[model samples]
Target: MKMMERLETFLVLAECGSFTEAAKKLFCSQPTISHHIQKLEEQFGAPLFIRTGRTAQLTRQGEIFLDYAKQIEQTMLQAGSAIESSMKTESSIVSVYVSQYFANYYFDEILPTLHASDPPYRLEINAYCYEALKQALVDRKTDWAIMPYYPDDDFIRSDFAVHALFEDEFMLVLPPEHVLMNRKTIYARDLQGATVLLPRSPFLIRSLQKEMDRHGLRVQYLQMSNFEVIKQAVKSGLGAAFLPYRAIRKELEAEELTAKRLPFFGYLRQNGVLVRKGARFTAEEQAFFERLRPHFDEGAPAGRSAFS
Candidate 1:
């Protein structure tokens, strides 16, 4: 098989996780998919996948190969699109990366405006978290990344520029019937010896520790990643938790939960727009930034406005 065809087969197999599924995706027989993978394995002189029952997992070499394959695929597609754009005199593709939080909150408002604009162009958006989004920008895999403000890092800050979009504060959340609900403000001392449900991220854990240390208090922590699970845990009276104001606004308004002001500690997080420095932007991306500029300028007047 040709290199491009084999590469396509490998990518489909990786996505679907089985030869049968890959065959279906590629509109070919399972045997053909198997033959392509077998040829690839022979050329590389190593096993690419570890088969267990009906499932297949990528081996170490396969994992490394997959990354390179994706980069090559993206480059080839970009080159082809560049040729097509030159031939037809059309605008180029605009690729952007956004975190899951921002995508859920703001994508709907942004998409419609782009769709109605002149000189129609392609828009590619990748929803990724911290490290993946950072790498995408550093590798020039994405043109822009919409995410929370990360402290300046060598790979990211040197090559990209970030614009502050908006800031939001973390809120002290409690069940409606919790004792803290009656209080106008809650202090770190108020949470001493209490169980605090928090996300299992180093940044958050470290920040919490610093806050607790400042007040000379200690608390038990229930660490988990799923937001819904954390909410449920808190609602069951298992513990108190802190979340971004935007995340719990509906619950607070519905009176399902109550929030109290934090004392002395700001507990703020900023969201920013990250773009590759000196990277050329297509018309669509330029128009997106133009539309986005006003919202950031408006800032957090109420101290808890939703970017959505």
Candidate 2:
């Protein structure tokens, strides 16, 4: 049997923990599955599994082998994808991880342009929270990530390149009946002694706290992770919270929520594109980025600004 076939059989056996189950999964007879594993063990000169009466467990050697098998499988898959992409005039698959806010607001506008190009592309958007977004990039599960402004991290700076796409300011969201709701512009000091609902992520919360500290203001609030939940809490008069202006635009326009611009918040969140550093872009991705450049430029006039 071929090495690839043996590797596939081994992976299935590891996952299913039985020859019968692996056979069923691979749609082959039990003997065929057993034969593949037997050959693999013979070639490696090590027992791969600890056979009990009816169950099997991976030996220490098996565990190490499994890791390499998985890596090989992934590399093979990536190689196959690369070849398939080359055969086509343009590849359709472009996977991306984008924040919920960006997916909801800007993806549609960008899609039309991508679709209009030759060798049409299909965009798969994975909407993830902060941590998941970073993981997707690290795992190479996504071709790109769209995220809010973040502090420069060594990993991201060294392994990924970021392009600024747009920017929006943070605003205080308050219930219409709240005391601060009537203010044309909200100051951080107004939050003192108030139950402010803030996002629970340490990175985001810390950034907000740092900004408040610089201005000698303190906001005391219960932290919640879900943005929608925070909005509901604010609307129900539970507390005030901060959100990007774009995120609350509809609510502000409909008067469902009142948003006061925070002048004291010196920095605006730059929504940007992130691509893996030193990774060669497929032709389609290169073309897609080229087309996207103009739209990113056009967004600057609205509020997009560079951070020093």
Candidate 3:
């Protein structure tokens, strides 16, 4: 048990990259975290981390040990699951991590129906940025992740099972009184001299730059970190933005905002659900996945080859 505690502390410290943050997460003191890490290094016969200022970076040996530590955690989880199944006790709770857009726009409405079914499966959903979403799966913290997929997204490797979902189209969103609101179609060239509000997503920014360059338009950009903030910026008449249709669906319907097709290709944002390739799903988790299937686009065939 002491060794297990040490390994757990090591994993958390690696994940956090800071002993102070790891201590806060584990509800322990910094000295205790240091003690556990020191013991791990002694058992492994090597210094695991190279400590700098306030950060702890894994050495080559530490990187190798991370995989083994994760395997131990996973094995324990499986053993617990097996014991719980034998006892036929508590319901299964599956954890899913998703992007903020999905949480705000889609899942709020979908969760109710999912929770109401017979033999209702317990679900634990956490939302994070795209990078954190991927890390959660790598660390085995979450069972699945849902996020926007891009053509250049190389992270969806062979080790992942991907279900390519719908393409959320990027549209030109405008305030009701904007000059472009009266235009029949919003073309890329038409964006000349227009200030465009943009989210800080690297993929979206790169795509936007490519399209702008293709049209030879030197448009002004106001970069924001939050999607809600981008939407409000457009609504406040600060600038027009290119956002997914689902993101502004309600505003368009209510006439608080106006949306137009981008009048060119390569504006679609693909999305997908991903799980680790060899995961063993309990009956309840499988049922929850089935319930979610009908709600999303029924386009992608099951077990589609990695997101390409």
Per-residue lDDT of candidate 1, residues 1-308 (tens digit): 38889999989888889877888889999878888888999999998888775557899999999999999999999999989879655355666688776776667766776676675446777887566677777677776778876453556567666677777677777899998788776776778899889876555567756766777768888897745567778778989887777677768888888777677656666788776766676555666666555655443333331221
The TM-score obtained by model 2 is: 0.63
Tens digits of lDDT, candidate 2, 242-281: 7887678778888889877678776566677776765666
lDDT of each: 0.74, 0.76, 0.80
**In angstroms, how far off is 270's CA in candidate 3?**
1.3
lDDT string for model 3 (1-308, tens) is 99989989999999999999999999999999999999988887999999997789999999999999999999999999999896664556766678888888898778888878776657777998777777787788865677776666566565676676667878788898888778886676678888988888887788877877787878898998877899888888898888888889888889889888765745777677776777766666656666676677754556433322
lDDT of 2: 0.76
User: Can you tell me which runs of candidate 3 are displaced by over 4 Å?
Assistant: 1-91, 302-308
TM-score of each: 0.61, 0.63, 0.66
Error of 1 at 182 (Å): 0.9
Model 3, C-alpha of 149: deviation from truth (Å): 1.4
